[model samples]
Target: MKIFPIPCLEDNYAYLIIDESSGEAAVVDPVEPEKVLKVANDNGVSTVKLVLTTHHHWDHARGNEKMKELVPGVRVLGGSFDNVHGCTDRLEHGDKISLGRDVNILALHTPCHTKGHICYFVTGKEEEDPAVFTGDTLFVAGCGKFFEGTAEQMYQSLCMILRPLPKQTRVYCDHEYTEKNLRFALFVEPENEHIKRKLLWAKHQREANQPTVPSSIEEELYINPFMRVDMPEVQKRVGRSSAVEALMELRRMKDNWTR
Candidate 1:
């Protein structure tokens, strides 16, 4: 399986998950349909088979109608609870779908950023590494703000649901927030060398105009303070005892954070 990230709007990302065995692809948040189709055509994909809408947000789901108009029979899918603009199908949690021959997609209900935010976990039947499209639920070193949910929901979505994925599973999120997120991670855990190194690396990547996503679950555990609320370092910095409190404080701090 091959995944291509297409930059859309300001910092948003649209991803293409292509099954190599066949020239079929599933696109995630194709907010810029023309660019996405251009990339797809550049690759071996002749027709896009699926459209995976992560949330109901305009930046994420705005181009669904255009995609429908572009691809005649493409199956557009969104979470069962979300009112996605042009969704042809509503998906429940744990719904499994196949793309071409090797790509297997699983929908996970991670609903903190939005009430019906769905993160797509994808794996290949062959030897390809697994991946998860986290939308606005999870970033490189920070999770999304509590827009429509509480701290407990964010904790459950980030820690309980996403934290247990395979350590090497590549994480793909919705925005180009890695540099800013790593800065926040450093503020949360100033002494964490992992965060420092990753921050520097992210700096270099941004300077060179490269994407810093596809961060592995293991890397996030080490550098992402939101996912490490139980750690003594994170709790001490946040002055919170429990994980939920720490997570809430972190979210508050991030929400008010200027730099």
Candidate 2:
């Protein structure tokens, strides 16, 4: 399986997951249909068989109808609980969908940013390493806002659900917020050398107009403050003792971030 990032409006991203064996592609959050289609064309995709939507947010799911009209007979998928536009198949937790022959996508419920937010975990036969499509629930160095749920839900989604995945699994989130997020991480953990170094790297990547996505679980553990909430140091920094409280405080800080 091959994954290509299609940079969308402002900082958003849409992805093309291609199964090499059959040339069948699964598009994730085709917010900008033309950009996605252009990426698909450039990649020589024979057919687009699936449209995987992570939530019902307009910026994420608004292009579903257009994509469906463009790619006739394509299966538009979204979380079962979400009122997604043009969703033909409503998926549930642990539901597995196969792309082509080897690229298997497992939908995991990761609600917090939205009550129906879901993340897709993808693996292929030929490709030993795996990749996860974390829409807005998890970012390169942060987690999404708790718009529809609480911090406890976000904790479960990020830690218990996404964090336990293979440490080597490449995390593909839906935005270009890594540089800003790392800056916030630095403020939260002033003495964290990992955050300092990652922030510098993110700066260089952005300076070159490059994407700072595909952050691994291992790297997130080291650099992401939200992912490290269970640690004593992170908890203390947030003026919280329990993991859930620490997570809540961290999120509040992120929400109030001005720069």
Q: How high is the CA lDDT of each candidate model?
A: 0.93, 0.93
TM per candidate: 0.98, 0.98
Off by over 4 Å in 1: none
Q: Relative to the unseen true structure, what is the C-alpha lDDT of residue 38 in candidate 1, on a scale of 0 to 100?
A: 95
Q: Count clashing residue pairs per candidate.
A: 0, 0
| Candidate 2, run of 10 with poorest lDDT | 124-133
For residues 1-259, could you state the per-residue lDDT of candidate 1 as single tens digits?
8999999999999999898889899999999999999999999796799999999999999999999999999999999888899999899999999999888999999988889999999999656779999999999999987887889999998999999999989999999999999998888888889999998999999899899988999999999999999998789899999999999999989999988
Global CA lDDT of candidate 2, please? 0.93
lDDT of 2 by residue, 148-198 (tens): 999999999999999999998999999999988998999999999998999
